[model samples]
Target: MTTAKDLLIIAIEVDPSGPVGQGDLSLALAGAELIDLLGTRAVTLTGDRVLPAGDAVPEDRLLAEAVASLDREAPYETVDDWLWRRGRDLFAAYTAVLEEDGQLTRERRRRMSFAAPRTTVAESAARRRALHRWAADEPVILALAAAVGIESEQTEEEAVVTNDAVTTVLAAVHDAVMELEAVRRRRSFENAAFANVWRGA
Candidate 1:
């Protein structure tokens, strides 16, 4: 079963322009893993929010710890809230695993005196093939695409869409775009719902 961490790594490698900073990349990766685990029934999601399922944690150390955290929550957390804050640890942990697996190598670079680790893809063809297959099969893209498209059509088909209704549409479109971007930074990640706003290519 592919975790979000794996998908993030693959996305980074596949994108020609790599991540700009470690912080953004790590959190984004963590969010991806959270979503993946949820879809696998390892956790639960209600709308965009995530709640831990009362089930045994998986054997995968990374996912197990994440699930445990969610399950142990006082009053469960939204997946974005949890991952955006704590994903750095998960990203670091998974990169070490990839380094050991010989698919990537890490090198440290100093950016304004702070050390930033750079990841180089070592096994390109194999990894790309795997990512491609995952992209084709993953449900996230479809969900996001539909959401963005529907929201845009609604807004455009009616010139006088209510302020409250427009706000709701924007929120849904933003959530979908954010998740889709985290998964695959490809051209297809865009939809007309965000035409007025800038979405990084």
Candidate 2:
């Protein structure tokens, strides 16, 4: 199954300069993995946490490793931490797979280097078409939006086209995060207000 991770590989392949910069690529790629896992019903969210829905281990290397990693710290973990940790490793693995699958052409010397190599997409029209379709995918759009912090009401509202359950789960989580953020903002305002009042006194 071509996942969000695969689509991200395509996005980077087509544009070596991606939507997000090098420093944020890991987080975006990791979020792509979560999007894949969530969409496939391989995992489910529980109050902003993620847990495997079933015992079936995946055959895909990335999926297998992700499920396995959850085991080491079972009883589930925060989606934030899990995605952050997984993003770093998945970026490397997916990049290698893209080169192996002929989707990306990389300089041999660059492969041996510690940093990511300069790479380009394959010259296949069919592969490009598939990627174009995936890029338009609602989940992919959501993941990309998330990666760059591009807030869009249209994207969230459009998420129903993918999976209503996933959209609902994400919305619930979003509400919680926003609420906490609002509280923090309010507290900061109050703190500043009191400080000004004390200075005036």
**How many residue pairs clash per model?**
1, 0
Cα lDDT listed for each candidate: 0.53, 0.60
lDDT of 2 by residue, 1-201 (tens): 355455555556545564544435555555556666786788887766777786777777777777777733466677666645675555567767766867768655444568655676676763666466545655555545454444334455565446654554444334433444577689999999999999999
Off by over 4 Å in 1: 16-19, 47-49, 71-74, 106-118, 124-129, 134-201
TM-score for candidate 2, residues paired by index = 0.62
Our model 2 lands, by Cα RMSD against the true structure, at: 7.9
Give the worst 10-residue stretch by lDDT in candidate 2: 168-177
lDDT of 1 by residue, 62-137 (tens): 7777767674554666555765555656556777777776767766786675756767767665477546644564
- Which candidate's lDDT is highest? 2
Model 1, residue 53: displacement in angstroms? 1.5
- What does the lDDT read for residue 105 in candidate 1? 76
